[model samples]
Target: MPEVKSQVDPSDASPFTRVRQLAQRAGLDGFLLALLGAILLAYLWPHFGSDDGPLPLNQIANYGVSIIFFFYGLRLSPEKLKAGLSNWRLHLVVQTTTFLVFPLLLIAARPFFDTGNQKLLWLGGFYLAALPSTVSSSVVMVSIAGGNLPAAIFNASISSLLGVFVTPIWMALYLPNGGHNSSLWGTIGNLALQVLLPVVVGVLLHRWLSAWAKRYDKQTRYLDQSIILLIVYTSFCESFYRGIFQGYQLTSILLLGVLLLALFFGVYAWILLVSKVLGFEKGDTITALFCGSKKSLVQGTVMSKVLFPDARLAGIVLLPLMMYHALQILIASIIAQAIGRRAAPEVPVPEPVAGT
Candidate 1:
């Protein structure tokens, strides 16, 4: 019989194919592409979802944010948190790095951005530092790196809960009095209503709904991302309308990106050193590296809505976080892959069989 020939379509050899191949090689996959697309679309059509626009996007996004946290609560496993609580030392280090060390580092950089809008930009950086470690990504990266998965989940979950209270207190120190529609106590109350209440309810229902939540996890994530994108779009629209981004030079934006990258690596290195100094095991060190280094875009976006009611300032505040989010995912993914490769179990050599 003649050997079978393989079929290859000419369309498969197109330039689009080559571009996709190159993108994959460089790790710029669909999610990153979608993020870029969202920004560009926000920039080009800022009016589409503006406060005075055709649709009530802001209101919808506000509700969506609450739902996102609700699902987050639903998905969290109390058993996992209980199991991981034994690692008190590791938890202390991760949380300290997140809320304390990260802020101090950004505060130290304040002298550099002491100019006009640069100060606001610095505030953005400070807010990013004050935010919590990402739950999903931190756990994902830790698992990928053969780390203590339970501890990662515990720290990330606890970090989010802590941020609901801690982040606003930190911001209150800097944010102008009466910038919000409500007083500090009122703001916290509102946040509790919108974010914390849903979370509490979801957690209460988790025993019954966890399996359902697990089944629809991907859809939940998609909803979260969509809500985030809507928030971003509305934020930029407000910024564009008020000319908040106009004063910012392109170089300034680029510098912010560079600074965010440096901040990520700097924190990562500090965490790694601390892990070593504290005599953490390899797995625990990996958990610290991932959990201590990450800042949650989810928490940042949701909290920003409640924290900064000033729409114009919200976009500026979110800028550093947005950049950090992208950079962290890119850098952490590469690092996780490297760590995973090192931790992978070696294949056992097969013994030659007597029959062979």
Candidate 2:
């Protein structure tokens, strides 16, 4: 047996290695694919509901963010609060970027949106800017990069919590097309019921549910992704059904894509520069830069009804969110990996010292 052994190349062998390789291979971004799928599903949504009734599928899509948040609470431990308290500076930078700088950038770019369609596009960007930082992906990036897991988790969760309030306030200040006449208190109730309530329930039961959450986390992630894709498809489908693109052209979308890419990279670069100037180490800077720049799709969707009740304008409001989410994931994933490689040699002591 030893004499007859055949050698396997390191890159060509092992299931774990192969799976990671496959994941790393370039393809259409998963979020983009999910969005496209959601659009197709949305197109078919109205058919399932009624002649003039809400599509059951679209209704299901509406709960996507809540479901995601519930699963989030189930997974996150109460320990996160303690962790959040420990890294005040990192949390400070991330929160400032998410709640302050991002929105400011969106506001500054408003003057350039002159075209009738351009305003909608700019509003979309602004809506995206108002949303909070993401939780899962940012933590994943930080963990993979060997940056700081506790800090990432803390900042990400706090950002989501903060977004529940900040997103609406920013909309009141900057969102242009006007849909704010709805009962603000009722909207708050809707947010509490749909988003925060489930999370609160899950957090309350986390002691009993932690093991279950850990076991089913992968399944829950799939569910989250599937629901989001459904939302994207259904939303776009409604646009198609309503002839939403009657005047909107491919050129406009293309231009918007370029602009979105610029916005993501520009904010990311700014964060990196700021973190460096502030004297953060490489790992903390990497974590800060990623955590600061990304926006939350879940937050945007859940908050939009309150922020922009005019369903006519809601889709445009979501455009920037959709674009930014996709771009940030792809760009940040690459940058995180590169940073991980560069910082590998300098990573702190993997195992703690003996006897404390």
Candidate 3:
């Protein structure tokens, strides 16, 4: 007689288990949080419009981001940077793609965008290209895939440092000077303050507080993501409030979303292939593909205040940045799963051992 096995059904007994199973099945509880935040924004926005009612939650969220960045600074360590510098070549490739190759692609695509809602969207795409690679997400993805975490931390930090200069140069070359946009010097100052300053402070205190950072990593991480999701919701709210999305047909925006998605994944696939061709091991390849393809939403928004100013196009300028941020997280999470499985192969058992 064959033995029988029973499987547990989460739905039958506990509601808690059922929700957990559902979230796992759909993948990305963070994304679900982000989506929920967006829904809340849509619901509460109308009430917040009046002067007496209350301050807009979006503005509250932006303030939260500033605080988040300060804590982000507190958490970064010099050790991570030093270790990443040891494998400078791997970091170099990722930085080159993020700063150099990506900008070239965006520039090349400009002619195609010359007609039809292309100009604004092109600026958005260029903004996406110019921004730095992500730190937290890159490290998270690498860790999840069982890849090199220290290298991810190093490369991601270095990329952020490089963006302080590189992103402005790209913007100056691509965006014609408007009367309101900040000069290059002002942009640099803003970058120094908003990005470099906090990170530097974090590094300076690393020796004293690194252990605490490790212990509280999970809590800080949740706050970090919540802040980003808030930023996204607020950005979209501003765009929606300003009638930016309304000006364009719903179908057209949907089409652009698909196009942007293709562009994102296309570059991701290309990098994965290139990393393999360049003789990177599976772990390094995973790092390169993810770190290379990501753009930093936090940097873009912080810069937008100085670069674009309190202008009508601010929200529109950031539309591509928003789309790219969400897309990278969703797509990379999926790819990381696949790469992790491949990298950790299952060995076959010898059948003769049983007979012996």
- lDDT of the candidates, in the order given: 0.82, 0.70, 0.68
RMSD to the hidden true structure, all candidates = 7.0, 5.8, 7.3
lDDT of 1 at 19: 84
After TM-score superposition, what is the CA distance of residue 151 in candidate 1 from its true location, in Å?
1.0
Off by over 4 Å in 1: 1-27, 345-356
Off by over 4 Å in 2: 1-23, 27-32, 40-55, 63-65, 174-183, 305-309, 345-356
Query: Which structure among the candidates has the greatest lDDT?
Result: 1
Global local distance difference test of model 2: 0.70
Per-residue lDDT of 62-164 in model 1, one digit per residue for the tens?
8987898899889988888888889999999999999999999988899998787999899989999988888877887787778898888899899998988
lDDT of 3: 0.68
Query: Which should have the higher TM-score, number 1 or number 3?
Result: 1
Q: Count the clashes in each prediction.
A: 0, 8, 0
Single out the weakest 10-residue window by summed lDDT for candidate 2: 347-356
How do the residues 1-356 of candidate 3 rate in per-residue lDDT, one tens digit apiece? 99989887655768876775555433435454564566357445723422223666555654564565566667766666676677766787898889988888888778877754668878888888888888777777776676777778888877877877889878876564664444777666766776567767776777788788889987876766666655555555555555555556677567667867987877787787788778888678778887888887766766665566443456668877766666666677766656665666452211100000
